[model samples]
Target: MTRIDLHAHAFSAHTAPKVIATLLTLAHRACPGFAPHGDGTLPDLLRAEAAAGFDRVAVCNIATRPEHHAYMARFLTALRSGAMGEEAARRVIPCVSLHPHDPDAAAHLKTLVALGARMVKLHPYSQNIPLDDPATIRLLALIRDAGLPVLCHTGHDVTAGEDDFAGPRRVVNVLDRVPGLRLICAHCAAWRHPETLDLLLGRPVGVDLAFQPATGVEPIIQRFALEHPLEHLYFGSDWPWASPAEHAARIASWGLPQDRQDALFGANAARLLALP
Candidate 1:
């Protein structure tokens, strides 16, 4: 069977290495207990993807600083154009972003897309912006006009302080304003699991099983696949946060009936994205 790891992340070494290294150092200094894992480098992620038999992995890089936009844009252009080191680049599809609340947010998004951003990554928690903030409405309009999907970070981000709600319910407010925009709720919509399922049962939005119980939630994910239109659901590992091997194993051990497993693992994403 064809394998498509729809949600995994890897950074281009050519961009932001020094900044990322500095951040890693600062993280250790600020939180002595925080031991970072191997940086999700291109080579490491590609190896993991290959081992998991993933033919394509969509990498969504969210912005953390103003300067990051251009660097990330360039990196994404390389991925979309198949310019990121031949072998590693082939499996990665790059998602783009601008701080949704940025002052020139709309223009930035347009520039990113023109530079080759296939989708946008929005993080309410880390970005410190309410999902329904007026700026997001404009941002959503820009996305809709561009005909790109928005992969929203709709859950607790372990590193960012828990001041915001990453719940799917909050996103409904934003969705209400831009009903036609394509949205992919990352991490199974976090604490809003069934509500997330409910949202998708009636409407088409993408939900990724990035951190769901490697064991417990398998049945729920499978149930959703069997009960809902297959195109509305997608499987993503949130790699670097979760391993490809672990994600593959989790789906395998779920022991779902063959068709359901096929949908969750690959078919659904291919159909949703209109991939081959």
Candidate 2:
């Protein structure tokens, strides 16, 4: 089966070196003993994913501040224009980010679609915005009208403060408000908050098994597999934070039926992205 990783990240060459260094440092501090499997560059990410047997990886880029919008837009433009080598471009699918505080957030979403972005990634904790804020709701409406899928970083963040920006409760509110929105709640809606799974079940939403370790999450995953439709669950490595190979191996060891495993690894993502 063709394996598609629905969530991953790699720094663009245009990303400031200082910013990259800061992010890497913060990541290490947030998760003690956390070691990245690849350097924070596109080429390195591609190599790591290839080594892990991933056929395609969606690289999620976030803009914490408003200024980052144009820069990321330009980067996506160049990437889609083949400024990056064809092989690298083919393997990496670009997912744009929009800060809820950005005044031109809607415009940037349109720009991403024009540049052939299949989806967008939202990190409310990192971006410091509430998922149910009016501005965010407006943005979701725009995405819905554009017919694009959005992958939201739901649950708590180690680096964040007291605010529950992307918690499952807020996400559920968003879903209730924005009917027909194609949404993917990352990290199984915060594995710690298993109640999120109950809220998400039977909804027209997607959930990715990213950052979930088999040792602790296996039972939860098994329960989800049995209760929820397998078609909405995607396999994601959450690379740099987790190992793609390790996650794939864990999924393989789940002993799920071959077709269910196939759906989790790739087919579900393909259908969501409308990939041929």
Candidate 3:
């Protein structure tokens, strides 16, 4: 099977200004902004993913505000244009997000789905909304009907806690409502292991260890693999946020079985996404 990096990012110069501005604003409210302290552009993230042996990766453009839809759309257009004039752009599979509460978001989402968006990325923390909130519930419904997978950030507190959409419980509600909606719970539901464990075991949700640092959550990840095997878990670099070398090293140091390692690195995501 081909190596597939389920998670990745490609920054578009066309949308950088808006993203930077939003991050600056978020940095004021949310502890960590969209970009890391010193993270570079999409190209920088692409280099890291490539060096880590990822064959292809997904590009997620978030929509936090109603006005952000245009910027997100432009970025996706540039990424999938095959006209970005860069090699990295070709490797990207675009995933666009929409603010569930945005009045016109539903219609815009329909348009994007028709154009070939395979996934929907939602950040309750950045948007300061809960995943189980009415608006989000409706949004999930729309995305589900479109046949797109939803990748939601669950766990930890960059700024807000459970109230801001980092709660796995909220994810559970949405999942319960939309039982058929495919979801990738990012970060192994970091800091919410009990809930994350429950959801994964109870349902067929997939977990990705994207930001597990060498000293961060390696032990727990190793334990989870031992407990559940790799078919239910996926490896993600969460590029621009964590170094690919760091993620690769963790896997190397753990020395998991070859089959399990292969599943974690790519096969699991392919299975979840029903990829080629």
Candidate 4:
């Protein structure tokens, strides 16, 4: 089976070591007993994915602040240019980040796309911006115009408490403003927000199974999979934060039909990403 992880994160060579360390520290502080499968470096992420049996992995980079935008563009450009070694580059898909506060956000996005970025990742909670804010709407429009899909960090973050920046209600509002947007709601349709599933049921949106546990959410996810169009679903590990093999195993345990499992594992992502 061609397993493609639609969501993951890794730091490029250009990323500051301090930034990587800070993120890792924050991750550990947020989730007690959290042990990252790999360090936040690109090479480590590639090896981790390979060890987890992933054929392809998409790295979703998030620029929490405006200053990180340029760095993100350069990093993705280098990755796409195969500057990070060919084998690892071939197995990785780069998703650039966009921040609403950046004055040149649209231009930066255009440059990143020209440099071979096929998708964008948004983290409203980390960016400290509301999804439906005016600037965010404009950014979403620009992303759609650039012909790229966006995988947004929806629902609550483990570290950030009670922030609904990318919650289901806000995402629904965003859809209302931007017609025909190709958005993927990360974290199994907004973790604790099952209502998001119904809200986005018939829309042109994709939901990734990232950071979702099988014990409590598997039954809900399975029910949604059966009730909704399966093509709208995609498999994601949220690597470093979760185990790809474990999540894959959870999906396998769902008892879905072979075709549906295949779709969830890769087909749906391939179609959405226009991957050959």
What TM-score, over all chains together, does every model reach? 0.80, 0.90, 0.82, 0.89
**Which parts of model 2 are misplaced by more than 4 Å?**
13-30, 212-218
Mark the 10 consecutive residues where model 2 has the least summed lDDT: 212-221
Give stretches of model 3 more than 4 Å off: 10-38, 159-164, 192-195, 198-202, 212-216
Query: What's model 2's lDDT at 166?
Result: 80
| Candidate 1, 87-182: lDDT as tens digits | 856666667667765677667777877775667777776567766778767777778888888878775554455455566667787678888888
Clashing pairs in 2: none
Model 2: lDDT equals 0.77
Candidate with more favorable, higher lDDT: 1 or 3: 3
* Maximum-TM-score candidate: 2
lDDT of 4 by residue, 1-276 (tens): 678999988765566466556665765555555456656677777787788788899988888888787888777767777787897678887778888888998788878888788789998888899888999999999999999998998876765666678778888898899998898888745566768667765666677877645224566566655555778888888877677888788778877788888888888888887887
lDDT of each: 0.67, 0.77, 0.68, 0.78
TM-score of 2: 0.90
Better of 2 and 3 by TM-score: 2
- Which has the higher lDDT value, candidate number 2 or candidate number 3? 2
lDDT of 3 at 240: 56
* Clashing residue pair totals per candidate (backbone < 3 A): 0, 0, 1, 0
